[model samples]
Target: MILRVLLISLFLFFSLQSSAFSLEPVYSLQDCINIALKKNPEILASKATVNKSFFKIGEARSGYFPQIDLSLGYQRSYLENKIGEEYSKQYSAQMSLSQTLFDFGKTSKQVEIQQQFYKATEWQDRDTVLQTIYSVKESYYSMLKAKKQKETAQEVLKQAQRHLDLAKGFYEVGLKPKIEVTKAEVELSNAKLNLITAEKQLSQALLNLKVAMGAVDMPDFDIKDEDYAVRKLNENEAIQIAIERNPQLQAIKFNKQASISTKELVKKEYFPTFTGSASYGYLNEDFPLDKRWTVFFQMSLPLFSGWSTTYRLKQAESDIVYYSSKEDSLRQQITSQIKNLFVQLKEASQKIETLKIALKQAKENLDLAMGRYEVGIGSSIEVVDAIVLFEQTNTQYWQAIYDYNVTYAQIQKTVGWVE
Candidate 1:
């Protein structure tokens, strides 16, 4: 009975393990980007900032509404007078309302400033999203590249095994020497080593992809291979698009507008502000209290504050200058980045085309060398050299493809083209 129970338990465990392994999820490039957008910490933080800034607009607009407050108090006092020592208890309740009559657009300017800040945060959030998407794409492409390289390594190992078998057969049949068999063995061992390295690299790439997607407890997963088509882009057009659509540039523009509004608000601080307030209250030492009411209007004028207002105005003006210069700097920086990325993308595209031809030629060379060696017309050295060349060309071709895809992603990010 004990043996039977142990056997059944082992079988069930293996079955469940197999089922779990077979159910691992496969994510596509788009799926990875979606995951990153939803889970990336930077994106979440930026979105929160955007939400916080939106509430600030409402806070600033609150100045347009009346302010109301209520107060209740109880106090006991002792006094010494000519009659003797006396104690008194007092209770009071009061409600008051205050409203700003006018202030030369000070409140309005404050609202405008907050609105501009809200716009800036919105753009900043967009920028963060774009950056996150780019990171996901980069990591996804790197993982794909590693996967392809691993496949290539496996193919080379197969080729090496075939060569070794052929060399052994030739040696046994007296068509080749023992040295040929030894060389083939060495080549096979090298192929196995390369495959091991490729597998390690692939595992590292997967870890990097998981990090980019902000996945903490992700199960083993696979990514589907994708075909990317190349597109032609003009540098001038790309630069123009980046200048118009870049989130950072848009944010800076809004920030500068907010600074200008702040300067306008400060200028109005020098003018007088008119306000009105009314209070109704009851006060008495006994249960039955007397009622009192008062209403008043007041004006506040800034006479002098050690030239602080003047300094504030100057500071606001300086902020405007700083932002203007910053805007210009960003434009130039974006233009330069666009130009550089375009150049890199073009080069990578060209390399893909070139390496495609090279890979084909290498395959033909490897096949011919193998055939010649089998017929005893070619040397083992020739075949080994051909194999190495084929593997190198194949790896380079895939690397070029990876570079093209990554560069294209960067260009999309720089131009604010999200998909």
Candidate 2:
């Protein structure tokens, strides 16, 4: 008896814990975007790349600082001469410092190259962030649309059930035939099937939202309903904004600048590098040691390197042309994308307005049909048709809204809008 009671108590405790764990958290659209920015692997990787590029700039500037090195050695030798055999031991330590006095602005140009590359990486990071935000918004709206579709299915099912009950009552009173009952039953079955499909779609949409948030392991959650205001953009203005703010375009421009700087730095390879060096050394065979010091200046010129320097200069020049061409191509693509998205946004807006009106009319027609049937003036077919029409129009209206929101997100992404 005592063991039985203990087992029951433990089961109850675990049941309570399970219930608490099963509760889902609700998040707004902005909350999902924030989470994605913080946790998305793509965004994290892009940020890491930006940091690495920034460090490269410091690495390039290191060429301007003096380099110091230390060395130590121990030696023992045995020798035989015409008179006798002898052995000697030696210990030595040396420290050396070298500084580049001049490289014809080579170091400065390298630093400039690295700086440009860093700027390009920063813009790339921004582009990743914007893309992630757009993904989150698109998924969020899709999930909302699915949820509304499920609700619509449920409502349709209720109407089908009501019609089934009315058909049975009219038949009992000898006002309707048995076929009417069969028709209502068939409609109810279809409604059930539709509701099941809608539920599955909603589940899939939620999973998609989770992936977009970069939190696939996150617990089940709900999203708050959001309404978007209609917005229209001027084609010329949108194109200008995309040109000015698009991260890809900016990154390409910086890359071109970096290539130009690299070419200039490469040209300096034909010139001589001027450097100064100083060294101090100690040597001894016993406890006390003799000290020696030396200082000197040197110049090194690349007289010939199998034309490697010349080839490198050519490569740098080619990179400049390649990036310049790439920049032109990207600008054209951006302009075209902006134009297409603008047209989509307009079309979605119009559909939303038109579908909303259609949805209202559908609802009114359904009401009229149901009222006429209640007054014994309408047939079962009329009522079922009205319900079906209402459901289709309602679904279309929600779809249009979803399309509008997604198009708006695409436009923002194309324009490089960040928040």
Candidate 3:
């Protein structure tokens, strides 16, 4: 009975685990950002690059530590002569240790260079995170826009169906022409086709959002829609923030510092390097031991290396200049981007206001047209024209809203706002 109970318990546990794995999770915008940060392959790779920089530091610091080596060997030799063959056997053990006494600060400068490189890598990782956040915001907003568009299309289809029904009823009563019914049917067919297209667009948007989230499969869930308000911002202040806080710029700054350190390290090559070494050896012939020890200090100076040292120093100096120029270029680019996005955001906000008023007028026109047609005072074409105008205005209004939201996201990205 106990064995049977154990088997049932195991089966139940496995069944629950499987169900959990198969369940789809609904995600908010923040949830998507967090998941991408945790699962995106590129983000993980950038993190690993940061880790590699740490190991490089350890490698650089190894120059300050002592190095030791040991060796053991046995040899046998036989010589043939007229009297007889004489045999000789030898055994040896050797050990050596070397340490850098000084190199005019060469080792220390190398360590400093590696430290700067690590800093640069850390900033690069932060930049990766910022980029991921931007991508998630874009895809999330796009999905929301697609959903709104689909809803608009469905409403238009319903309006078309109502028009069709009214025309058919009038024709049955001998109050409308056959051509009106045919036109209504044509409009209904067109509305249905548009709705189908809208649905396909929504599906594609959902797939894009899932890809941005780094999800293995698309989940079935509703996204929470929230109204976005236009916020006031200062362009000059935004540009200042980007220059001071942008991770890409900061990474380039670190790279420049590393290059400077490398240049200093190359200059040290002009001075002599001092290294101390010691060795101990023991040798035996026929089991008799002869022991020896030796110690020495060596200094090395580059008499000439085909001007390689000079060329290396020049290369490091060029790197410093290159990074400095890149920094200048990036700052200019940030300024231009902020200015451009600010204008677009403002224009979109104004457009939304105009579309709101237009939408109101279009709805009123549709209502008037429908009332006239119901009273047999207006033609079906008037009602149909009003609907087309209303649908167009409605789509334009939603599109303006989408444009505003996307422009705001671009501004946030330019200013290096991670959230």
Count of backbone clashes, every candidate in sequence: 0, 0, 0
RMSD of candidate 1 to true structure, Å: 4.4
Once superposed on the true structure, which residue ranges of model 1 sit more than 4 Å away at CA?
1-23, 80-84
- TM-score (C-alpha, index-matched) for candidate 2: 0.91
Instruction: Give the alpha-carbon lDDT of every model.
Output: 0.92, 0.92, 0.88
What's the CA RMSD for each of the models? 4.4, 5.3, 6.8
Sliding window of 10 residues with minimal summed lDDT for model 2: 226-235
> TM-score per candidate, in order?
0.92, 0.91, 0.87
Off by over 4 Å in 2: 1-23, 76-88
Question: What is the per-residue lDDT of model 1 for residues 1-419, given as tens digits with 9 covering 90 to 100?
Answer: 99999999999999999998788699999999999888888988898999999999899999999999999989999999999999999989999999999989999899899999999999999999998899889889999999998998998898889899999999999999999999999999999999999999999999988888888568768999988678878889989989999999999999999999999989999999999999999999977888999999999998989999999999999999999999999999999998888888999999999998999999999999999988889899999999999999988988888899998888888889988
In model 1, residue pairs whose N, Cα or C atoms come closer than 3 Å (at least 3 residues apart or on different chains), thus clashing, are none
- Candidate 2 structure lDDT: 0.92
TM-score attained by model 1: 0.92
**lDDT for model 3:** 0.88
Those runs of model 3 whose alpha carbons end farther than 4 Å from true positions after fitting are 1-25, 72-90, 285-291
Candidate 3 structure quality by residue, lDDT tens digits, 1-419: 99999999999999999998887665787888888998877799999999999899999999999999998989999999999999998999999999999998888898999999999999899888888788888888888888887887898888889888999999999999999999999999999998999899888888887777777574565576858788888989998998987888889999999999999999999999999999999989856669989999998988989999999999999999999999999989988988999899899999999989999999999889988888889888899899899889987888888888888877777677887
Q: lDDT by residue for model 2 over 189-234, one digit each (tens)?
A: 9999999999999999999988988999888898889876797578
Question: Which pairs of residues collide in model 2?
Answer: none
